[model samples]
Target: MDESANKMNKFDVLGSMNLRTKTLLAIGLSAFILIVVVLVSFFIDPTSITTDWSIMNQPPSLEHLFGTDWMGRDMFTRTIKGLGLSVQIGFFASILSSIIAVALAFLSSFNKYLDSFVSWLIDVFLSIPHILLIILISIALGGGAFGVLVGVAFTHWTSLARVLRAEIKRIKTSEFVTISERLGKSKFWIARKQILPLVISQVIVGTILIFPHAIMHEASVTFLGFGLSPHEPAIGIILSESMKYLATGNWWLALFPGLALLILVLLFDIAGENIKKMLDPASAND
Candidate 1:
C-alpha cells in the first residue's frame, strides 16, 4: 500500500480502539457473570434450602457468602433468582423495543406523509416520562411482570426510533444508496441491500444501551408493586419484601440484590458505549 494509505489505515485502527469499544468489552465480562448466575439459579433451586437460622443476618461468612435473610432463605440464592428475573425482563423488553424502533425508522423513510406522521408520533412518545408511562401501562394491563415487559418495551421505543431515524436518513443519502436509486432499484431492495447493513451496527448499539434501562425500570416498577407480581421470584419483589425488615438490622436482606443490580447495569452500560465507538464512522474515517 502507499505510505499515505498505510498511515491512514493505522490511524483508523488506533481510533477504533476507542473508549466505547473498551467499555463494551468490560460490559461483556459482566454479562458473562450474569449469565453464569442465571444458569446456576436455573439448574439449582433458587428457593431450595434447609433453613439455618444460625446463619441468618451474618455478614459474608465463609459458610454463607451473602448471609441469610430474616426467613432464613439463602441471600445468595435469592440474589441469583432476582437477577435472573430482572435480566429476562430486560432482554425480552429490549428486543421488542428495538424491533419497534427499527420498523418505525424504516417506515419514516418509506414515504413523506408516513415520515411526518411517524415523526409526530415519536415526539409524542418522547414527551412522556418513560417510568410514568411504564407504570400507567402496567396498571392498565393489570400490573404484573408481563405488563412491565410490555410497558417498558413500548415506552422504550421512542428514543431508539429517533436515533434510527437520524441514522436512516444519513444512510439513505450515502453513495451506494444514491447509486441504487439512480439504477431504479425498488425501495425495499435498496433498504435491504444498501441501507439496513449500514445502519445495523447502530441498531445493535442502541439495543444494548437500552437493555440495562429496561432491566432497571422493570425492577423499579416491580419493587414499587406495579410491575411483577409479589408472589413471583423477582429481584424487585425480593427487594420490596426486604425493605420492611431493613430497620430491624437485617440489612443483608436488601443489600445483595441491590449490588447485583448495580453490577449488571454498569456492565451493560459500558458494553453499549464501547459498541458505539467501534461502530462510529467518524472514528473509522479518521
Candidate 2:
C-alpha cells in the first residue's frame, strides 16, 4: 500500500510539472510568433514595397514568397509592414483603453453620483453599433492611424470598465476595506494599496482581451476607407485592393495577407486565454 502511494505521488508530481510546462509553452509560442511578426514589420524597408512594374501581378513562386501585386510590389513585404503597423496601433490602443477602463472603474466606486454617470455613459457607448461608432470617431478625428487609435481606445473600454467597477464595488465591501476606512486611510491610499493590487489581474486580462479586437477594428475601418489613407499599405488597403483582382484568378493577393492577419489574431487570442488561465489559480492546473 505504501509503495503504491509513493508511486502515485511521483506520478502526480510529474503530471503537474507537465501541465505547467505545457501552459508556459503555449503562452511562449504565441508571444514569440507575435514578437517576430512585429519585429519583421519594424525592420523591413519601406522602399521594398514600392512598385516594380517588371514583376507585377506574378503568382507565388520561388522568387516571391507571397507573389507580386498589381503594382509589382512584393506582397510578403507589404503584408508584414501592414501587420506591423496594425500591431503598433493595436498595442497602443489596447493600452489606452485599459487605462481608461481602470481609471473609470476606480472612479465609479468613489461616489454614487460618479458611479451613476459612468454607468450611464458606458450604456450610451455600448448601445451604438460598434463599427458605426468607430467610423464616426475615425472620420471626426481626420481618418488616419490616430483616428483609429482614438476610436478603438474610447470604444473598447466599456466592458472592461464595467467589470472593474463591479470588482471595485465588491472590494469596497470587504472587511479590510472597512478597516482601512476606520483606520483613517485616505481614498487614494486605499485605492493605491488595496483595490489596485486586487484588481490588477483583471486589468491585465482585460487589456490582453482588447488587443485582437483593436487590430481587427483598425483593419476594418481602414478597409472601409474611413481609417488609413490609400497610400498606406495597411492590411485593410491590401485586402481592399485585392478585391479588384480576385475575379482575374489572382487569389494570392488577398489570401496571404488575410491568412497572416487571421493567424496573428489567433495567436493573440491564444496568448490572452493562456495568460488568463495562468493568472487564475483555480484554473491554473487546467
Candidate 3:
C-alpha cells in the first residue's frame, strides 16, 4: 500500500509541474525518437538501397516492406536513409544559420548605424521569395549538396537574427549591464560574461525552430531539380522519381516516402514549437 501511494504521489507531482515543463518533456521524447531513426540508418547496409530488377515495382508485402520501386530499391530502407540524410543536412544548416544570426545580431546591437544596416539587409533578403532565392543560389553554386547548404544557411538567418536583436536590445538597458559598464568592464567582457549567456537560450530555441524549414526548403529545391544530384537517395529525389510511376497504379512509391517525410517534418515541427513555448515566460502557465 505504501509503495503504491508513493507512486501515485510521484505522478501527482509530475502533474503539478508547470505547462512549460510538460512541453519540454514532450520535446525531449520527440527528439529521442528522431535520434533513434537517424542512428538506425547507420547500421543498414548500403547494397540494400541499390537496384534489384527481380523486385521491380513490387507492392508492399512481407518480403519487401514499403514496396519496391521501379528500380527495385526497397522503399522502406530508402525512405529511412533519405529522411536521415535530410535530418543531417537540416541540423548542419540550422547550426550554420544560427551562427550567422548570432554574429549579425551581436554586431547590429553595437550601434544605431550598424543596427539600421543589418535591419536593411534582413529586409532585402525577406523581400525575395524564399524558393526563388534558394534556386538562384543553388544554380550559381552548380546545383549540388554544397549549393543547397549555402542557400539554406544564408536564407534562414533573418528571422532568428531579428529575434536575437530584440533580445539584446532589451538586455542592453538592464540595470546590471549598465552598472557593469560604469564599473569599467569592457564591452567584450560584458558581452562574453552577461549578454551571451542571457541570449543563449533564445539562440538554442531559434536553431531548433529553423530546422524543419531548412529540411523542407532543401527538399523543395531538390524536387524542383535545383538541389541534390539524382544519384543521391534523398527524400526529394524519391518523391520526384515516384511521380513517374504514380499513374501506373504504383501509389505506394509516392505514398510511403511522402508520408515518411511528412511525419519526420511534423515531429521536428512539434518539437520546435514545444521548445519555443517552454522557453517563453509568457507561455509558462499555458
Best-matching candidate per TM-score: 2
Q: What TM-score against the true fold does each predicted structure earn? A: 0.85, 0.93, 0.90
lDDT string for model 1 (1-286, tens) is 6999999998998777756555556667866887797687677664475567765666667777788877577777777777877888898999999999999999999988999999999989989888899999999999887889999999998888998898888888789888888999999998888889887897898899999999989988888889887767788888899888888887877888898888888878877776676677766433
Q: Candidates' lDDT values, in order?
A: 0.83, 0.92, 0.90
- RMSD of candidate 1 to the truth, in angstroms, is 7.1
Q: Which lDDT tens digits does candidate 3 get at residues 1-286? A: 9999999999999989888778978888888989988997777776667888988999999988899999888899988888888888899999999999999999887789999999999999999988999899999999888899889989999999998999899999999999999999988888889999999989998999898899999999999889999988898998998999899999999999888888888989899889878777798678
Model 1 segments beyond 4 Å from truth?
Answer: 1-28, 46-59, 281-286
**So what's the TM-score on candidate 1?**
0.85
The better-scoring model by lDDT among 1 and 3 is 3
Q: Once superposed on the true structure, which residue ranges of model 2 sit more than 4 Å away at CA?
A: 1-17
Query: In model 2, how large is the Cα lDDT of residue 215?
Result: 96
lDDT accuracy of residue 83 in candidate 1: 81
